[model samples]
Target chain A: MGKHTVVPFGPQHPVLPEPIHLDLELDDEKVVRAIPSIGYIHRGLEKLVEKREFKEYVFIAERICGICAFGHGWGYCKSVEGLMNIEIPLRAKYLRTIWHELSRIHSHLLWLGLMADGMGFESLFMHSWRLREKVLDIFEKTTGGRVIFSACKIGGVRRDIEDSELHGIAEILRGMRDEVREITDIFFKEPTSVSRLKDVGILSKEAAVATCAVGPMVRASGIPLDYRVADTSGVYRELNFTPVTTDTCDCYGRCWVRVQEIFASLDMICQAIEKIPAGDIAVPVKGNPNGEYFARLEQPRGEAFYYVKGNNTTHLTRFRVRTPTNMNLPAMVEALKGCDYADVPMIVLTIDPCISCTER
Target chain B: MGYLSFAGTILGGLFKKPVTTQYPLKPAVLPEELRGRVLIDIQRCISCGMCMRKCPAGAIVVDRSAKSWSINRFACVQCATCVDNCPVKCLRMEPQYAAPGTVKQNETFVKQAAAQPAVAVTLVKGVTPTASAPATGTQAAAASAATAAKTAAAPQTTPPGDGAGHA
Candidate 1:
């Protein structure tokens, strides 16, 4: 047995895009335990709901996390809309679902690039991001903003994608499918990546459920727990959405799930475009929302929960967001146990931790 | 799983042109739908303050008494809520972003009193400009101008608390 050494890992690290600090207890280069300390980037976004009107708080919600901006906004709107008993038009739901799927593809690509970068594969990282740029271009062309798309409003979507434009977006995604497959194939087939990922950071199904893991983390552990399956708010049911799962229960499995999700999201977007009904995008919301509702959404990373309480006023009484990263932290810490100290970054990245979302 | 599995991609990438543009050297491509900066047509502004009321960032200030609208570009989140809520359709989202500045300053657009006669004519045609209560259009316009001059002469006061004062 070696002497224990405590190594403080971040708030700043090369591999981490967001600031998150972790104290790793190491015994001769093996991590005995990883103690995560968050709250580095909390913006108190939920508190702003009191200041901004219920209608306007969607903008604040959208800013919670840049990568999951659309989901956050949609979740907030869904909660408020539910509170107000407003039923949005069918076309609006379809449009929102399409944008959500598009964002999922972009987000997964971004994670793949970051994962490659974390694995010290610079070229693969660049290639992954290069593919991601096309998705951002699609976002810019359709929703205006690449990262912070304010297309979602309280009652419904702010802008409508013309049927032809929707078809064009679908065609663009289809065209990129081969290229995406080519890039993602390297993650699976490349000897170095396989060695780095496979059999590393193993989180058993029991441990995953015990730690309350969400999103790909749970899916990677052979659990088909996807909020999209249960969520009635979006058109996921209409599209016949199914959660992607794998039994590997390691870093590789997480990667595999995310990569598969990229393709699944693409297919879902195309399906939505084909089946989208033509109708009014939004109906006028007349009065203030006066109730409390909890809205759950399937973000690219995981399941996000939004709780909103409105007291018959323009301002909401309380707004709370439970991001997927927050739920996955315990599972992440559990996975980190007995991991090589060198593999800590990889293990942490496997959770796709968005500290901003968690802290917000 | 071969060690050189990526070698083919590497060699092919060398032959291919770089996917990224030179950006500044190549004047980056911008989409038409890009939400960049808020612009106001002062001539058409009714001083109704809808933009100010709707701006989530509290970046806009509409002074009805002064017949002026001002936006702090640094504070604006570029959400285009103001553009959507503008009653007179005076607000627009220009694709060109405001140039970065060393100092934070408010860009003020004051409706020229000369343009008021046209607005006054529209107001008098029973259009019921939402800016103020019902009154004879000519007198109301003159009174607003007088108040504008009075407020302009006085030291500037801070705009009301975001959306709270209206309620």
Candidate 2:
């Protein structure tokens, strides 16, 4: 019998952008179990609702995760909007979708780069991130900030992109399709990439559903459960949104799903730009929001839920965000069991962990 | 699979220029819409304090008494809320980001007190009558001068003589 040993993995691992500690129980070279401990980066952001006015809370919400800043900002606004019953303009919805999809593309590209880096593929990581910079350029050109957009407001959006500029953005994304395809091809055809990813951290459909995993984690396991499809929120429905899922239930499948989703996001953005209506971008929202409302969004990692309760005052009574990584921790533990210790980072990267969002 | 899968892509990149440029030496061209640093046009500032109130980071400080506006660049989040909420449109966002510095930069914009009208002297005398107050003559004169300068620049609905009743 092999002696069991506990190995603590990362609050400051080179691959991780945010802090999250995991204690892995190992039987020789195989990981027997993984116990995750969160809260290293907890800033008590939810409690700030008591102090900051609901209008100003959007800015704080955007800070939850720099990668998914637009999504967090949009979700907070959506919750408050739902509570206040404020109907945003049609143009605002289209604009939000464009920015959100752009965010999705950048995030996926970032994950791909990080996954490559984690797998010791330096050139691939650099190539993927180089492509990602173009997406960030689009973001900076339209929304003003590469990471924290700050373009989202309570009732609607803060700025508007001209149709010509939107068309220009569409052209850039169209050009990106070939570059992304090239990188994706390398991941698929390269023996090194396949050897590292394939047959590692396999999660069955049954176990994934049981663990209540969300986003690409479950999607890669063959469950087509996408929050964008399930919730029917925002302009996703109007834009012919489609969820990309795979039946492999492995690390490679997860990578494939994310890459495909990036293409899907690009298509969605182009379609949104094509069908965007001409109208006011924002509506003046008056009075404090009353009652409680829940806003769910399909963030880059997965479905992020925001629950907001307001008391008819500037200050909110309660506000909370349940990020996808928080939901997938149990799934990560399940995936880690019986896997080679060397595959820990690959398996963890497959879930696209965003500790900042989780701990916030 | 072949011994080398990256060969084609690697060969293709051999002739292409590097994606990254020499930054700081030759300035990278920023997008027109890029939100970098906040700049204030002091001449157009009305001291409405909207920027200070709306700034989520609390980076802006507007001193009403001194008629000065200062922004701590490090604390500013570059959210542009201050620029958007500025009533007079005095605030603008420049595309050039503030250079990293050892010293924390605090940019203060002070609007020189507007030209005091000649009528301000007589109006100040009416507003503060020294007959009943313990204030010395010099103190009264200085206080009245400051008040007179403020009153002259600001819009008025009633004549300065209305304060004569209070005096």
Candidate 3:
């Protein structure tokens, strides 16, 4: 704490939507350290998973966080399916990929809106969120929830998206792309935004990869390990997947990567619409599974890993989740260093840290 | 060139529409079976204890075999695995995804009539009712079901006057 003033960025802040406490050590205007203190919104997901039966944990997993609900649910189901050696139906796999991309689009747009808010660009914030509503509309129509999509299940999805709506939903996503493109252009064109963001919380390519800064943050540093594209043998191959990448490895670079990703996700949704197969939504799974498996999925934020161990009983023995935000926290803590005090919020916003996921 | 792009940026703000849709009054059109809260069609439940066994939250309990299902609503996460596993097709996850009450838990889902028995052979992968089941003779099954129906219909008060004379 030598020659540094300690200031607390709280569990509730104007800039950050997720509640997190960070003790910032500032030397003049630059940040020397950002020691984050978490555990504010812990839903005790791990403890609850122990009490609930393995199959029933899907809802509990979905409730872990509002933003990453679909990914958490998907991770849980995949883990259970793997333990049982249940080969998921092709239709379910495809449907799952659809929801995952949809979740990514909505989550990124939401983050973009929040980032705009941090810059005091209230209009831009509203505009991005306006575009985000279309994604939410589609989500509610398909799975019946705007945020927490409990659509994913043990072997497959719970409900089927009507084949009739596929053509229309595809059209809706395409329309959203136009607005997203316009908004991204605005964010880039705005002098205040660019001046505030460009070269502001620089995490180099080597740093990003070594620290496992994932999702858009890693891509901004030019790392091309996107699970959707890498997991092509599963469902990504059927759909067109364009990995969003950038070279700047700065705040604007992260923003651009997310903007580019929205278009890629829209393209994926269109491809899924064309490739959607006809079949039952889910296969009934029975008996207590007697094995352990880890399911890794590409969530919007980053890699979401679910480790499930089932005894020869109805209840799951051990259920563990390695959320994306948890992996990014180290990088986030590092990214905050050497940033201007006034720009500290912008650096934090760039990570799009879903603290609920971290605490859960 | 910089000024030209800056000029275009200034004009863009005026055209954009406001995004906030008034909550509560405007009303969000939620999805069907969206997990706002748990709803049970109690009548369809066979009280087979399937929901209790499969509950991830351990929120549901059944009493009086195939007769009543009790659910502690407070603890329920509304996973709907119980709805999925019900052999009777009686237990259902209803469209009402939310409710508000001061009392957190409910001791009962409710007592309701059981749905028709599942006739089609369904393959359930994990849990109970293993891969094998009682073999079926299509025609014999129909005839035996009819006879069992007649036996169940027979009254207990047989020949009341004859029983009185004997006493």
True contacts kept of each: 0.92, 0.75, 0.62
Candidate 2 CAPRI grade: medium
Give DockQ: model 2: 0.61
Candidate DockQ values, in order, are 0.71, 0.61, 0.34
Error of 1 at A222 (Å): 0.7
lDDT of 3 by residue, B1-167 (tens): 86688777567766775455666767765566465555566644445577678776678777754445667777876667777777667666655654667877666655643233435443467643332222223221232232332324323312223322211
Model 3, C-alpha of A294: deviation from truth (Å): 3.3
Error of 1 at A226 (Å): 0.6
Q: After superposition, how far is residue A357 of candidate 1 from its true place, in Å?
A: 0.7
Clashing pairs in 2: none
The runs of at least 3 residues in candidate 2 whose Cα sits more than 4 Å from the true structure, single-residue gaps closed, are: B1-19, B116-167
Tens digits of per-residue lDDT for model 3, A200-273: 88999989978987778888999986777666315887766668888998999989988888888888889888
After best superposition, candidate 3 residue A239: deviation in angstroms? 2.3
Chain B TM-score of candidate 1 stands at 0.60
Which candidate's lDDT is highest? 1
TM-score of 2: 0.88
Q: Candidate 2 at residue A80, lDDT?
A: 94
TM-score of chain B of each: 0.60, 0.59, 0.51
A174-204 per-residue lDDT for model 1 (tens digits): 9999999999999999999999999999999
